[model samples]
Target chain A: MADVNRGSRPLSPHLQVYRLQIPMTTSILARITGNGLIVGSLVFVWWLVAAAAGPDYYAFVNGIVTSWLGLLVLAGSLWALWYHSLAGLRHLLWDSGHGLELATAERLGLAVVIGSVAATVVTLALLAWA
Target chain B: MEHLTDRKRAEGRGSARSGTLHHIAMMISAGALVILVPLFLIVVVPVIGAAHAEVAAHFARPFPALVAALTIVVAMHHFRGGVEMMIQDYWQGMTRKLAILAMILLSYGTAAAGLYAIARLAL
Candidate 1:
């Protein structure tokens, strides 16, 4: 006799392992921003190549970076850059045997987020208001 | 319960050969970046929306040009190490090896490109 129905197979899904928290979310965001910077750096290569290529090409590449969508992306990438760098600093602190306490760890996580925004804003001000 | 002996553990020192090297290299680059990145932005942001000639001249200066060069080089190294870890986390098998190779090429290629452009501008 052929078995028509198999008994319910066990399904293990991993989504519920940890309740959402700032440190966890920020850690994931750090990974995201770290990779985001890689992609953004590729564009830096293009811009540099275009700069060396000539004036016409420079203008062409410049147009893209200065455009509205490009501006948004540039701003976001700037934020990511600051965020990623700050997160790396936090890691370095952890490596040096600092910020191991739970309260300090959470504070450092929050500082990364706040500091990134501040850095981005200051940069934009320097760029625009200078 | 059986546990590994201290002699056995001590014998396996640096079996991977790259033990702590990756961590140390990455941390070194990160430390350099902590300074270079801010200096780069300070030297760079003012010239962003300016004309091409203006931007070129700004980088032609020794200070800005040197800062930019160091930042690009160190940043690419950091970027490679970070991205490699992230990629390894998501992919495995042949794809992982291939992706890591591609990332290395991309990082160095980009670094070279930026350096060349800065050289062209400065010289």
Candidate 2:
């Protein structure tokens, strides 16, 4: 007979069993930023294609990219670039087997976050000057 | 004990595969960018000019022209690899996953066609 009062069936235990590590955390963040960059790159592609197409298409894209909305997209792209770059460096270090220590991993993670913001600001400054 | 050992082996295999794929993708992207960015800056930018220039002028220099070609190729390859991984993560159903894969292929194809057209242009 079926148990009418059964609440749930046994499921695989995953989150409770695996402990988080630095490489895992960095990989997760990289995946997120990588996704962001994918979308942002598509936007860039559109702008480039439009520019290449002709003046009218170029103006249309230029109008959008120069607007507040465009600025937001640009900012997001910058963030993704910086995050991905730092994450790439971290992966490079890991490839060389240097940052496996927990403390070093944590420091690098923090640097990735901080450096991304700093780089973005510098890029924005350059864009403004241009 | 046997089950535990099997699970450990499976985990190890999975991690190694994932790490290898990641490394390969990163290497390709890094290598391509090394060739592409400079070309865009030196050749493509000057020819395109700040305000106005004929499309032909844009491809005036061979080095910049080659860079533009590499940029399209490398950027598309890098983008497709990243997007494929993302689709694998977020799409659970087989049909949806297949759809995403098709979309990625279509995108790469379009970019390739566009690049070919640009290359054929005398500018």
Candidate 3:
């Protein structure tokens, strides 16, 4: 006879039991970056709204955003945006029935991380020059 | 033992039968973002530390204003869906419902505010 309380059974091993790998790290990064982008989005929106509000308010917000701490946050957000975008592209590839093999998947994961960093650097450099 | 086909067993069960819709929504937004995001970056990045007037004048251009508006709408919609899935995975009961509600509101509110601001700049 099946136990009526089978619903209470313990679930399988979770994060604590697993060894981290490139794919796992990249997947976790996808979520982190995706959620993390809200900060940058909020700040950018505030800047826009403030600009629309008045020059004083816009100056205040702009001053803060141009500060060192704010620049750090912006840099982090830039990297996160790039990482999430690339990871999303990787997912689209998987959805199309490719890159499922272990080696290819891992390689793609590595590419996402490295590519995002490179993209961020190039963006920042271009922004500086412009 | 109760008998049912595998397909029959799979039917009518899963996140209120909207899993595919959610996935398609994410994919569509992702596709849109692939285009809009880079365009937005190109539009906004140059004026990051520019003076108030310059920043406003920059966004006032048709290209920049349009790109920013579209990116805000689509990205927020995508964010809402992604956060809903995250909440579903980690939360339950009323907390999950409330969290989802909060995220949805946040996403739309951000989008509305952003669009309004852009509209002001463009005008």
RMSD of each: 6.7, 6.4, 3.7
What are the DockQ scores of the candidates, in order? 0.29, 0.19, 0.45
Candidate 3 Cα outliers beyond 4 Å, as residue runs: A1-3, B1-14
Best by TM-score: 3
Model 2 regions more than 4 Å off: A1-9, A12-26, B1-26, B34-64, B113-122
Judging by lDDT against the true structure, name the best candidate.
3
Residue runs of model 1 more than 4 Å from their true location after superposition: A1-15, B1-17
DockQ of 1: 0.29
Over A1-130, each residue of candidate 3 has an lDDT whose tens digit, in order, gives 3223445889999999989999999999999899989999998898889888878999899999989988999999999999999999999999999999999999999999999999999999998888
TM-score of 1: 0.86
Residues B1-123, model 1: lDDT tens digits: 135555554675535767489889999999999999889778865565567888788877899889888988999998899888888778988999999999999898889998998899888
Note the clash tally of each candidate: 0, 1, 0
Q: Write the per-residue lDDT of candidate 2 for residues B1-123, one digit (tens) a residue.
A: 333554454564454357577658767696666556545534553332233245545544466556776766776677667667677666767866786778678568756754654564435
Error of 2 at B6 (Å): 14
How high is the lDDT of residue B5 in model 1? 56
